[model samples]
Target: MILTKQHLQNNFAKARETNSPYVFVGIKAEGVSEVIVIPKKSFDAKEQFYMNAYSEDLTHVMNNNVMITGLSYGDADQIPNII
Candidate 1:
């Protein structure tokens, strides 16, 4: 799924008010992805100050929850590594 700028802003606002983290998964490219954790403060700041648009891609399994996937599960592990 793709998150529009407005959706991110709204979620950021909610997270700011609740002092919670907002998590999102984004596909960086074909066959690659990333999980983003936006802290309350950072979310507020980004939404307040950043005017540029942003988007996030998520997996079909994860859906709209806080879970993020696509990270590598291996010996030399990286949070967003593919394969």
Candidate 2:
């Protein structure tokens, strides 16, 4: 089944409940955008690891990254970055 934004919203809702990381791959113009929705507890470790690993020539690309939060199930229309 195709995963729509609604599916993503539901998944994130559940993740928020269990405090788990919600990861999803979305297509973007530049490349594949990997969205990892982690609660505050998990974000710190993930942030450190990604920052270290991606802290090379990808500084510019990473700096342009757009993060979205508090999106409702129907707010997929708001995410123009998601294709």
Candidate 3:
């Protein structure tokens, strides 16, 4: 069977109905079959901020319960890596 964009959409629709945090999908192309799945990981607040509503102002994060820790940037080159 040939996989089309509709197939992918159907897969996503089915995934959304399930309670699993990750979705797995398989596709066949060029006589090869491959499986794809989203990896389930602990929710990171920083990622949510960056992906959903990231802003340089950071006023929202400053005022929200976003759990900001390990903020130790005192010098120009002392910026720490955010999770």
Taking every candidate in turn, the Cα RMSD to the unseen true structure, in Å, is: 9.8, 10.6, 19.4
> What number of backbone clashes does candidate 2 have, counting pairs of residues 3 or more apart or in separate chains?
0
Error at 46, model 1, angstroms: 2.9
Q: Scored by CA lDDT, what does every candidate get?
A: 0.41, 0.39, 0.34
Candidate 1 clash figure, as a count: 0
Regions more than 4 Å wrong, model 1: 22-25, 48-83
Compose the digit string of candidate 3's lDDT tens values, residues 1-83.
33333443443444345533543433233444444334334223323433344223222233343321212112223232211
Error of 2 at 73 (Å): 16
Candidate 2, residues 1-83, lDDT tens digits: the string is 44334544454555456555433324322444543344445544644454453323223335435322222212234234343
Flag regions of model 2 displaced more than 4 Å: 21-27, 32-38, 41-83
Cα displacement (angstroms), candidate 3, residue 55, comes to 34
Model 1 C-alpha lDDT per residue in residues 10-56, reported as the tens digit of each score = 65555556555443333343444455444444654655542343324
TM-score of 2: 0.31
